[model samples]
Target chain A: MTTVISPPESPAGSPAPRASRGFTFPTRFLPVIATIALFIAMFGVGSFRYEGFSSPQTLLSVLVDNSHLIVLAVGMTFVILTGGIDLSVGSVVALSTMIAAETLRAGWAAPLVIVTVLLTGSVLGLLMGLVIHYFEIQPFIVTLAGMFLARGLCYVISLESIPIKNETFTSFASGTIEIGDYFITPSVIVALVVLVIAAVVLHMTRFGRTVYAVGGSEQSALLMGLAVARTKVGVYVISGFCSALAGLLFSIYTLSGYNLGAVGMELDAIAAVVIGGTLLTGGSGLVLGSAVGVLVLGLIQSFISFDGTLSSWWTKITIGVLLLVFVLIQRLFTRRTT
Target chain B: MRDLGLRFVRHNLFWPTLALVLLLLLNLTKTPDFFSLRLQDGHLYGSLIDILRNSAPTLLIALGMTLVIATRGIDLSVGAVAAISGAVACTYMAGSPDESTAGRAVIGMTMAVAVAVLLGVWNGFLVSVLGIQPIIATLVLMTAGRGLAMLITDGQITTVNNSLFAKVSTGFVLGLPIAILIALAVFAITAVLTRRTALGMLIEAVGINPEASRLAGVRARTITWTVYVFVAFCAGIAGLMIASNTSAADANAAGLFIELDAILAVVIGGTSLAGGRFSLTGTLIGAMFIQTLATTIPTMGIPAETNYLFKAVVVIVVCLLQSPKARAVLSVRRSSPLLTKGSAA
Candidate 1:
């Protein structure tokens, strides 16, 4: 997370190490470690309690079930890394899902359906970015408006759930690549591929560095000659693409689209991102960490369901507790650093 | 005289007033009785009164929001805090019934206020002392506070059979809704406290330049912390009013999206999201404007679901108008010598 450490400053004449070696571990790594530990612990407990919990079916189901969320989180990570947010992602997902499902129902080719949904999402996000960056409006406000606009459009298209009657979508959704009794679903593979691509973009590119620089200090980044506006717009566009992709993936899984399908899913994505150690203040986070965060949340829900007594509300409660704890920890880490 | 009139037209208040007027005009075209007023049961009854009554919670929240935003901070937890407060207040009222139980209501309120205050302080501590981003800090509470509220009520809506509690929201004092009076009182108090003391100046200074404020020994941390606590308190009050109005504590639905509405009102009132300056009166007007729009839509036979869409459009327009670039453009247009040349020549 802090791999590109700032050059150390020496008060005295002595030169300091270019990268400080104290503790060596980045502060952001704490949440990532915690998430992994939690994932392992939950898996261990689930396997112990339920015979099939550790089986390939359970693993595939969990991954396939939450692939859409994973996609959304990947997109959210980019936007958050740029020190902005996209509250409209959930609404965008709904709108995109509706468009995709309707297109498929209308006998459009799968490629056309995909392209239309993605372009629509990107255009909406680009407009939002233009308004926010050019007009100097708050990202929260602009995205809030986007949320309403997208959701309204979804409603306008059809308030009722539009079922995907296309055989291609159903086949793709149910299709599995079997490998000696361990099957991998397409959605899971797609999510994994997206995660890898996102991680690479975030860690290895000049654009990634620019994102961090802008988030860390916009003024300093401007002074350092970073393309602040373009980077900002890029992040939102990436988020929009991710949301659109997630929407399409979700429609495949659910076989239907409705205006209220992903209501408050943005909150869940945000919670996962934070729990995964992505600082909302930006400048640092890991895509892998977010992937694990989504798994951890999925595991919590699975555990709750396994218990049979606890209602689904417990999921929200658990997430809330984790969010508060992570945030407080983030506060402490930031305090010690600055 | 014409030049002076033009300057007045270009004032900050001009846009909000014009927007309000335009909205009102639109309403008038749809509903001829938009301007009709009556006194019913010693209470002023009209669209204006309805606007004020409906706007009470939003006005209170936005009033608090203005201060927090003045410090260049946002409180996403206000809605959650309100939910928590409602849960606490109603749950306590359900547990007791005597006049002395009203004291329990007070205690419950106090406890809810304390919890809300602690949450705010926690947010303040992060933003001021720990340097955590305001959005992240408050988001923590925003997620957890609602769960805590649900947990407090055991994830169920608790119905209260308390008269005093109902009266707090439902009763009339001199024909005005008790909620309206409470809202007015809260507004008056916040206005006086902010304007009459060094709090407002310190808050603006901290928001404008925290480093400079700290260097000047302005106790930026304390000021930030105080405003958060104050904001949470206002949210708590709003919670009580809502719970009392329904006579039931709905942990799930109470004050849902209220934070967004409050933020909208604050923005519409011309408070910069980037912070430093705020207007309580402007926030009140902004809150009323939203309520008016909502009330007007249904009165004009627009479907209720369309309210969200309309509000989104209105909020976007308001945000655009208040944006720094838009303001800069407007200022340039107003100050450009072309108009002077066109007039003088």
Candidate 2:
């Protein structure tokens, strides 16, 4: 694990490095700024090209449509920042959705159902984190197993989609407040709260800083006397909790819990995170960037739908291309900075 | 006796082979006629034969995966590559004026495999040339390859009408399943190609320490690029087998989860995910074990949805059992006096 690039000792005196630095903004905010610009550009293009797109309602619709992704991206930000991954998040979301729907259907209270789903997600995450930390297995493998386990559990609960009939849950799901020409739902609000809290924690809190330290260099973090192990495990738990919350939101939005729900949503989240300018190799990302990333993807889907002739698969291709471009950009940025 | 048992358990191939054997024994106990093989029209027919036949696709992919992982890389796009290959072949055959001819099928397969090679080169370019992380690089294709497949098939499941194509998966040559024979042939070729040359050693050297190998004058980039291409070729063959088996190509579903299954096989076969040494024989047994488990799951009376749950549990158990910490804990009081300190945890 040698450091591929170390910071130059004399940044101010080198001509080639100076030229690149002059062409670029601060390296830390370069990706986030690029992401915001891309989102705005995409949204602007969609508004001008697509019919019925130039409205606040449509803007709100983007958030509404991608509420689950927003939450998942935030959670994924934490895991990726810790140099770990959680492929289980999507499956865990599906499992939580199934549990929420089933428990709600089984004559249970909304509070009880919510707690059970959240608890299930947290426990599963904690277990995977423990295996990854204590057993010294790779995060990818552990989370992969977790993904299978969660998906399998979803099927065990019910092979068919379970529709929510709980009155309170339905009301909460459908309840929205009109903000001028646009509207926002309870779920959107929840996602925003999670986003803000995540941003603050990541930027302002010791635990979040510790997560960055661990991802930056585990050995150094340990030598610096940071709680590397606990932070590593805790990030996973936070991810699990976020995934469950997202699952709850997805279930509410769809009002059904199918085992096959969110088949490749985890990939979508990862794609959004990368497009939003997070380095996949870990260390250095922003939560707000993930939110913007989700919007970019949502806007792409919206434009595709509006076109009427294009297939949904085009979104996948677009995301793939975006992922490639962003990764290359990150590479250039890191090379210049270091 | 104790020493023999210790050596056997400690062997890399032991657990995977033992797992395969135990699965077979489990099948035998449940059905009582599981191991009974009979000749049907000069071809073998039985559970044992079925395991070999069914595991061909997985075996091919895992064989390639063994090499890929051995180089400290992973190709998540193998499943997607399988889909694209199937789509290309099926679409080509369906459009052929004389779809029934073996010649048309051959051309279609060649074109399909050629596309797969191109795709593999794209992956290799991103990884070796551009220096993108292997997982992220392959992930680009993994995300978009299916879309490419769908485009090739015009968003439909393309079914070709060709006996020659069907024969690729179902037909037997010299009283052996064609699929099984193809897998073994590929295995034998790769075994000889790698073992008989410097390729295997070079791959291991690159996997162990790329910088060190480069400094030592080994052509690490060439080795990495070759393995990626080789892996894509294997996936292409597997795609042909899968499509030929069904006589149709479903872009959305063909080779779904094969990457995970292949990775699981490689791990179960005792190949370290961290790279360095690999074992083709171990991967063979590991693939067979998975196919057996796939066959055995339905008989357990569990719901279909919970099948993956069972697999997850078993995979976790196997991985944990193979983990250095778990092994140290288990063998602590027996042999090594410093076992307690050796466990990383």
**Model 2 CAPRI rating:** medium
lDDT tens string, model 1, A1-338?
32455565664764333246664365557779987887898899999997678786766767878999999999998888878899999999999989988888888998889899999999988988888888888899899999888887886777688999888888998899886887877998899999999988877998888888888778778878999988898889988899999999999989888877898789889988888888778887888888888988888888887788886667877887787777777777665565
Worst 10 residues of 2 chain A by lDDT: A15-24
Worst 10 residues of 1 chain A by lDDT: A15-24
Q: After superposition, which runs of candidate 1 have C-alpha atoms over 4 Å from their true positions?
A: A1-8, A11-31, A45-52, A102-110, A177-184, A219-226, A332-338, B97-115, B328-345
Q: Which candidate is the best by DockQ?
A: 2
Every model's TM-score = 0.89, 0.95
Q: List clashing residue pairs in candidate 2.
A: none
- What lDDT tens digits, residue by residue, belong to model 2 across residues A270-328? 88888888887777888989999999999888888889999978887888888888888
Look at candidate 2 and tell me the lDDT of residue B273: 87
